[model samples]
Target: MAIQKEQIRTALAHVLHPEKKVDIIALNMIQDIIVQDKYVSFTLEMPIKNDPLTQELSQRCERAIHKFIDQDAIVDIQIGINVSQQRQTPAPEPMGSPLSGVQNIIAVASGKGGVGKSTVAVNIAAALARNGAKVGLMDADIYGPSIPTMFDLFERPNVTVQKKLIPLVKYGIKLVSMGFLVDVNQAMVWRGPMVTSAIKQFMNDVEWGELDFMILDMPPGTGDIQLTIVQSVPLSGAVIVSTPQNVALDDVRKGVSMFQKVNVPVLGIIENMAYFSPPDAPDKKYYIFGQEGASRLADELAVPVLGEIPLGQPIRESGDNGKPIVLDNESPAAASFLACSANMQQQLAIRAATMPKDLSISFTEKSPSAHT
Candidate 1:
């Protein structure tokens, strides 16, 4: 019988990836298979480039084709790397002239609550400010604004002579939060529209003057309010925060999907509460959650794992004291946050260099309006 494509594919299915432990066909690595008279050509989309197993996989595929085809037939196998692309959707409406001067606006998000999303946002902003970048931190978590407590600032934002609300300053970073507008004890029992409106007002009414970067402490979950805020602003990118646990990583995938749907590039993932190490025995490491969960997720998503922050008492104390651990040079958490900040800055710089100047700041369809 003449050679058939299905027979060749069945043979190739026996070839498995050594690390992923799955057949190459099941992994969807095989693409663009073509069969002509006495000739066969196919492409292998590898996840990693220059992998040590590339040669082995190539030989295996050639052998598989030889088994089904005539002895004199030519079999051509092309090996190439495949990069994953984010899901695409229609871009959001153009944001008005609220954040014209801000070079980049980054949202720090999580799929669920209590993943240290706000803490990561605070420390990253503080680290950038320390590095001499003009930074602003806006608490977009209207229901649970923690920036006020994180920065230990209770003073209400002042209305300027021009009728604009001025963002409070702490740790050399401009800040705004619902905690500053309402009593800390009161619950924000507002609906979706109200919450979205408040976030819009925070973006437009607040006079955030000349910021190099704005770190938005986003609320947890992928709800309407989250969609509204993201749609209302021209976010440069987003960073997802999650613990080193399967549960947290599952939610993280949803968060990443939401940003991808909105056409916002995911900067990377931050693994918080990654591990624990006693001060007396710093060399010893303990994985309280699963080991390398976030790192594996990042790899799957084709994004970088910015940093793995260890769980420590000093981090909790600094948060409660309204002083982020990044400001405390003596703490180990400070070093971790600094490293994360550096990685984030490098990513931002690379993005800026590659993107067209006009496309760098905003991702809306309409032309940006003049600053009002």
Candidate 2:
């Protein structure tokens, strides 16, 4: 059977975009259709770079050609990301909030606890600071505040004449946390409204003046506290943190869903404690928590895996000593944290069209993971 351009178009017309619910031909997604000796090749125009649907849609087009056009035709599909024809309007934010001056506000969250989400949040903030970006770290985990002990801040926040609370500065990053307000020995015994009130105060009552990035260290779990915080603040995007374990990856789905339901773009995922490496044998890796669990999940979700941080003693020591691991700049763990932070911003550049372009500007060299 002789293949024609019109016949190829007819076959592709049967392929529909899952999200837009429109056939590729009507959407103008198929182009450069060339037919030679039954070898069919064409460019598949995707709506955005790194779209999760890129693979599935490309496969569908290939199958459509084989099943509908010619069973023996050879299919070669290439993907090209297209700038949206119509730019989406930015979502309206809460009026009169102090976050107006912040360039980008992102959340570091997890589906379940004990995934080292706070450690990742604190170190990412430190990496940004090391690159000379003005950064702010907020302990959104009202019940289990870790920023105070992580940063070793114990001084009570001072009030401005306007009655706004002044955020404390350490290591060139502004920080605020419930840990600073309550006694070190006491547990935060409060209701949902009280927790929401404290978070609102952190956003509205605190004086976090002009920052390049405001990183929220969100509490673990996808529950009422998490929902309340997301509703209370204008988050630019979110980063899901999980260990390379199936149990943790299960919760990661819930966390990602919560953000997606609220219209927040999930920038990427960070696979924490992916493996363990010994100082004596740097080349050897031990898969202590399972192998490539988060990577598989990211592939299924169609999001980028920003980094894979190895489990190590330095990370724990730095947290216990009130200094994040990235402060040591000479260590391998610092390099990993810095790279993860950079790749995350790269997603903010490519996936998040609603963010300011300046938010994607990299202070350091490009990240290795951004290639994905």
Candidate 3:
């Protein structure tokens, strides 16, 4: 006997939102249920995009569906933010007044944690620096500042005589991170306002002089911190990083949607840890997390897959040792990062060329007092 959509819905009815105390089907959160043979796919609407409950609910619903259907059946769940009731105003203009000297500002973000987002941010910045572009990497992951350990930078930034904070320099890349200001063991149990203020200071009070590119390593998820950073900067574009896993790819969609809602151009998606390749056997590839998951998601979202970074020991070792893999010219991971950076540069150029003159001018024009 074939499974029916109604039966799947009944199975999902057994699962309830912990807080809402209502089944997802009863709350009208499930939509477009498509059942084909042993396959089932549907969209799960999230009331809060970054709420941790979303993941939990997704897992519960998946388990419920499998209870009535074949255990080995492929169940696909897409998460969509329910913002139909929200106002449809255009995103604010780039906050370029305080950062007039920066030629471009790129944000590296992930929909979920543990996706190697910071690693990608650091390497991309390092690759851009190696290419002779003056680069700055701002570790905006205030709660979990790994940039300090990643770059082996432990000293606090020096305050200039003019009261501006001087960004620490390493590998020709100027860097700022919350890790530098706070103790390594301290937790940043801060609220939204505090996070917003800290990011503002990183931009306005830091002496990031003459940077061609400022790469922001945004914290995971679509939350207040992410919202503040994007709203307060004149971003050139955003690049999303995700491992090739269904769970990660689901969050990637939310991340993409967040950027699109804010009117920020999504440059591309980079599939980090796309596959594993052993050093001894260079020709063999291992899809430990599921092959091309991110690429498939990118295709569905109509974005380009900038690059596929393989999982390797050297990449992890380099980060732990405070050296980015992109600095190691001979490593395959380094080559991948460099190629991704080059693709990003090309995308920026294309965006500039295609954008209207007025819009382009807004991002590039320096304020008269900015030089003084």
Candidate 4:
């Protein structure tokens, strides 16, 4: 017989919590259990703050539940501690603007910097917009915002009637950059909290219209900024960009692992500066940056290699001139970006159908009025 929540609960009703010496299920430590087609995923509510048995309980639950179902059935388990009533009081929903418009939020990240991560971000956003999808690009690299330069916009964003700042738009792609807000000659030497607040403001205070995708050019490396963004934003997916070199590929693994750590599905990897194809002899290709490091990394990591962007003068020239190569729509670099965007869209659709749904936990579907 297939496993059911009732059966699992009944079985677990005998499993005692080491600290409380009470049945875990009966203690209400089990928050939600969901069984989908051939898949099982659930969240465990922990009562003790800083419970040391959280991981143990999660593993035991998974193992115990799988015994009733097929061994091959997939299980995703999340462990969370229940806070006190006073601590859990609902936060007031931001009144003026919520991130209600953007459909998909994608982070364009790199293991290390100088991998053309920002270039890939801008071109991909441009390509998606060109393909009839409304898009927004947020330069989350607080220390080094490049989206403003890529879009060729130097004007500071202005406040709207709603008091939210209107983001700059160019080539049909909306943009918000830390660079535009700060002096280039100065450095962003703020601490973690300061950077997080700025990123939050960029996300919540900007008037980004209904967008199909919001591409975040994340700061290189797995650090506090990365974790803050991952926790705060409901990211649809992530794309790692790297060049065809061992050093670059080494960092790519770290980048991918960070996303996997948080259960964020990686869309794919893009290999920038894959090769150089001379314009004169279009057929001849040169492996300027070694060979297929990204392809090798993807194969070993079991992720898709979205596309390989060649070393094109137009790509760099377009950046310096504030126009993405993808805007040209005729160059090979532009074609590669368009292909990557298409592939990413397809991957996102597949993920949406398979990923577990968010659990909305509360007393009632609607809250009671204060007067009541």
Give lDDT per model, in order.
0.80, 0.82, 0.80, 0.77
State the local distance difference test value for candidate 1: 0.80
State candidate 3's TM-score.
0.70
Model 1 bad stretches (over 4 Å): 1-96, 184-187, 355-372
Tens-digit per-residue lDDT, 282-351, candidate 2: 7788999888788888989887899989899989989989998999967888889999999988887665
> Candidate 3 lDDT (Cα, whole model)?
0.80
Highest lDDT: give the candidate number: 2
Regions of candidate 4 where Cα sits further than 4 Å from its true position: 1-96, 358-372
lDDT of 3 at 147: 94
Weakest lDDT window of 10 consecutive positions for candidate 4: 363-372
What is the TM-score of each predicted model, taking all chains together? Answer: 0.71, 0.72, 0.70, 0.72
Structure candidate 3, residue pairs in collision: none
User: How large an RMSD does model 4 have?
Assistant: 10.6
Per-residue C-alpha lDDT of model 4 across residues 1-372, encoded as one tens digit per residue: 566767667755656666556667755666577777657766566644445787667666666665755566676665655543221111233544556777788999998888899999998998898989999999988888888778788998899997888988899888898888887546367778888888888888889867888898998888777878776666778999998889889999999998877667789999998999999976677998788778878999988988888888888999999999998857878888989888988888766644333322322111111101
Residue-wise C-alpha lDDT for candidate 1, range 250-285, written one tens digit per residue: 999999988877767778899999989899997677
What residue runs in model 2 are displaced by over 4 Å at the alpha carbon? 1-97, 184-187, 354-372
Q: Which ten residues in a row have the lowest lDDT in candidate 1?
A: 363-372
